[model samples]
Target: MTDTPWLTVVRGTAPLLLSIPHTGTELADLESRLSSPWTARCDTDWWIEKLYDFASGLGATVVRTGISRTVIDLNRDPSGASLYPGQTTTGLCPTETFDGDDLYRHEEDKPDAAEIEERRRTYFDPYHAALQAEIDRLRATHDRIVLYDCHSIRSVLPRLFEGTLPVFNLGTNDGRSTDPALQEKVRGILADTGVSYVVNGRFKGGWITRRYGQPDKGVHALQMELACRGYMREPGDKASPENWPSEYEAAFATPIREKLLTILQSAIAWANG
Candidate 1:
């Protein structure tokens, strides 16, 4: 139950592990100086950790970040690689929102290479170190390890996608990052829920999933990007400070939470088999 300022590690006994990358809202000082507080909160996964806090109760280890994505996206590759090549996507450190709008008033306000690297060194590296260490530990105890990367975003961002993203956007790099059976098991669960979902669709895991999901080593990774509208009010109006408050009632979020845990448990069980 120890705490790392950037991330939280919830120790557990299950073979599965959960990585909540976008749940963080702690913006770095430099980041706060670069963008308005509103811009910083706009792209947050927005209470995803709270929504999925039941992971611990389900016997799954949880690793979460408290730092804001605007500081350095834990999900994006540190090499500045594009998760969605030939498509609009944010980087390890994004200068703009998903809607193609500048996050900072001045381009110069953005993190320079040195600053970005510094943020990586300070925030991103430690978070991944913790994640990697947890995976290694869980692998030693369990027959297999599943890294469930949790994320959420506005359902419709024209700058990021042409149309509304399915409620559950599952990504596994077209099956390269995880076992076929494991992938299918998760898809089956989401499918049965009847909550509009697509496989290897808009999001197929991020750096953490792609980098750590080694089926050969008995470590499998999966990323689930949920649309905010599935649980919140991400209206068609321009996304602003006033309309999008970062709060969600548990009663309102319970069903989506259940579906997420269902996917994790099903994946873990299938991995064990």
Candidate 2:
């Protein structure tokens, strides 16, 4: 495996840049602080890198972080404010899982304010730096560039939302992050797939999309948060560390992967048009 302790950047020639921020599982030095290393990585966007492996073939630049979000969520606000205020959400350096399970054995084991800031400097900043550089590079060539942030989550988390999530949850910061036409085109493609999907519903894009999306400036950004069940077999309600993290079977993910390939192709065409 590649020793991507921090982040990995695969440069391509297309106007689209795919950002898989939560796909990493490497905990690095933070592994020692976890009560259960497996639980700490439970919320990772598993197999996302493999699902979008075809992006390189489409000439889409890929930027991914290998460090666990338990270390520092790259999609979160650096100010530690809630992305969905008045609702359940994790933090910059999360101390609990999406299900509200404790990540550390004790409260003292969690990172302090100073440690959170240190993680931002070490992990969060570099990832964004590389993403911004890619956007700048692509923007100079194409009249319009799209930053497609890829993510996935468990289908059900009562603490986060009621009932199961849609198969594809697209967000554009409530339509402020990208042009309405671009958003409509993508939504149209998803709708044709015959899969359940929503726009700017539960997830309205994260810090990365909101911070960089400038439609008027020719840079459009959008986030796609897939429910894991769309691509893989989700664990049962009482799943444990042993039975929870399912292996990535390409055969199982083919349907969604095919749809995603079309989505990326559409995004590239839209950007160039």
Best-fitting candidate, measured by lDDT? 2
How much lDDT does candidate 1 score?
0.83
> 117-227, model 1: which lDDT tens digit per residue?
999998889889989999989888887878888888898788777778899999898898888988888888888998899999878788988999898998888888899
Q: Candidate 2 overall Cα lDDT vs. reference?
A: 0.90
Query: Candidate 1 versus the native: TM-score?
Result: 0.95
C-alpha lDDT (0 to 100) for residue 197 of candidate 1: 94
lDDT of 2 by residue, 61-109 (tens): 9999988999899999999888898988999999999988999988889
Model 2, residue 53: distance off in Å is 0.1
Q: What lDDT score goes with residue 260 in model 2? A: 92
What are the models' TM-scores? 0.95, 0.97
User: lDDT (CA) for every model shown?
Assistant: 0.83, 0.90
| TM match of model 2 to true structure | 0.97
Show the colliding residue pairs in model 2: none
The candidate maximizing TM-score is 2
